[model samples]
Target: MTQATMTQTKVDNGVNVQALIGAREALEATPAAAQFKWRATCQWVNGTHSRSTVNSFFGLGEEQERPRSFTVDADHPEVFAAEDNAPTPAEIALTGLASCLMGGVASVAQHRGIQLYSVRATVEGDMDLQGILGIDDEVRNGFGTIRVTFNVDADASQEEIRALVAQAQKRSAVFDCMTNPTNVVVDVA
Candidate 1:
């Protein structure tokens, strides 16, 4: 891929400059109503497999319907008595983290007037399945640790890019959600 020209600051590097400006303006105009809520529904398909659909999300002022349907599948491996058709839930979670961070990087870079040629992130989580299988009470059911590595190519110094990533992480909702405790309620109908 070609390197981004430093002189061509007017070009948007995959991020929508106009949309970002508009969103910032809207938020500044109404800080109290800037909260956004996203929703998705999931249904069981079979053993260790499920599908989620995202159709609408509420934000800014009202509920907005999606222009197209978005679907995701979650499934375990065949070794776990699953069809191995789709990615496991843990894998999907990692994907979500990576995607969110990438978005943050792009948005932050754009806002800072930096032109980026490429940005990539690799995320890995260490998990012990013994807890989920009830084979070991000492083991945790989720990831014990998660690691992320970012490779960014931009017309900026390494220190500047590092600062950009740090700022992005601070602004990423997914990163906050993963690091902070969230209350979850489960009920059977």
Candidate 2:
């Protein structure tokens, strides 16, 4: 096929397939390029309220800057005896998971030559505040169960849609992080 034909076919589902493939190939050639260190700094605003800022990150073997700084505010609800300023940390976690999975679905669908018309997702995390409140020593501080449902509209069969969502879950970094345990060290600096 001609370059134009290939390019045309690669531009699907609002994703630049050619650019994505090129990035993968380049990263494969230089494995170190895939290593990234994402960083965010949080400062306390008041009781049970804090703000986190994101500006730049280390990726592609170098420091990369974003177009502008982004900030996220976290606070508890009135029922929790705190100001209802913004979403809680737990809600933020759910948002991160949903965003990552949706992004994966788009990319995977594009790679498989599928044209996606629309995709919507609902993510739920079941948490027991007993652990966080130190009311029950046996309870866990994190979510006990997390569920995600996707409603996808595309030029593909139901089986294909299911497979697409499954593949996206398999490839999602946030999904893996939530399901698996990682080393976390905390100290005063």
Q: Which candidate leads the pack in TM-score?
A: 2
Each prediction's TM-score versus the true structure: 0.90, 0.92
lDDT of 2 by residue, 2-84 (tens): 23244565436777777989999999999999999998999999999999999999999999999999999999999999999
- In the range 1-189, model 1's lDDT, one tens digit per residue, is 122345554647678868878988989999866888889999999888899999998887889898998999999999988799899999999999999988988888877777888898999999999999999999989999999999998887888789889988998888888899988778988
- Please report the TM-score between candidate 2 and the true structure: 0.92
Model 2 per-residue lDDT at 151:
94
- Highest lDDT among the candidates is held by which one? 2
Q: Which stretches of candidate 2 lie over 4 Å from their true place?
A: 1-11
Cα displacement (Å) at residue 26, model 2 = 0.9
